[model samples]
Target: FRKVVHIEQGGLVKPERDDTEFQHPCFLRGQEQLLENIKRKVTSVSTLKSEDIKIRQDSVTKLLTDVQLMKGKQECMDSKLLAMKHSFSS
Candidate 1:
């Protein structure tokens, strides 16, 4: 915004003398393309982040399930070892 120091001098936002560059069709289309590209890139990045989150959740669930299964097996093995030790002592 241009600061008009003297309001009496009539610098009240006149149109530019040459607007040929702004009026060019290529400039307008290029600006739209730039906006579209930025939106598309943001959407793709967001999608990737969502997919990564899902993958992380799935991996963590699988890991916990695996650990639970191993815990059960270990308990069973410990019981079997105790039984074997008692049999050997008797």
Candidate 2:
């Protein structure tokens, strides 16, 4: 003859037995808080990266505009120099 033991309160039986390695409530809460902190840090770093890129783009645009202005000035000076040289030679 064989005897059967029932550990669960209801008629439903769990597929796996409860292990002793379950995490404490406080430990689970601390893990959740750590995860949230990591998410916040990631978001702030992403925002900073976006701002840095925008600043770099603005700097590049300003530099390009300055270069164009310099080119125009150089062209005007070159024409004046050529006219002066021709007049001196004649």
Candidate 3:
């Protein structure tokens, strides 16, 4: 959902900072709710037809691919930061 995407993007922007107490609890609860929703959506498969299963599989696969790409990007950014730090230190 767009709301989840916005929340995730906002979190990434300040990934190194400690969230304020007022914001932390609400953000945590939002994350928990998102996780629960995803779990429920994924784990309730008993009634799905074959076509529905295929659709869900496609969506899950796409999501996994996106996550992998994001992870790679983050790793590259971290490496760049480390390289910059090393250059400054020397």
Candidate 4:
């Protein structure tokens, strides 16, 4: 008989609070790292392995881009939510 891999979400986490000050990179670098030794999509997978230590320009660039864009994203979200609230109540 073959084995089946079953996966299900715990659903205990609040998606909005994940990036709070307490956890830093939400779930500490990633829940994937703790559960499966997986790293961020654009970072070094394993520091223990020399082959995985190489740095690519795009990797760091994407991180910086994300940080810089966060404020703008929040602003857009805020405006969209306000508009929706007004329309919803109208």
Candidate 2 residue pairs in backbone clash: none
Clashes of each: 0, 0, 0, 0
Measured by TM-score, the strongest candidate is: 1
Question: TM-score for model 1?
Answer: 0.47
Off by over 4 Å in 1: 1-48
Candidate 3, poorest ten consecutive residues by summed lDDT? 21-30
Ten-residue stretch with the least lDDT total in model 2: 34-43
lDDT per residue for candidate 3 within 1-90, as digits (tens), equals 223333644755755545443222234543666444442124556777999889989999999999999999999999999999999999
Q: Local distance difference test, per candidate?
A: 0.64, 0.66, 0.67, 0.58
- What's the C-alpha lDDT at position 58 in model 2? 100
- The residue pairs found clashing in candidate 4 are none
- Which candidate wins on lDDT? 3
Better of 1 and 4 by TM-score: 1
lDDT of 4 at 64: 93
User: For residues 7-74, what per-residue lDDT tens digits would candidate 2 score against the true structure?
Assistant: 55232655366532333333455366644333211355556777798999999999999999999999
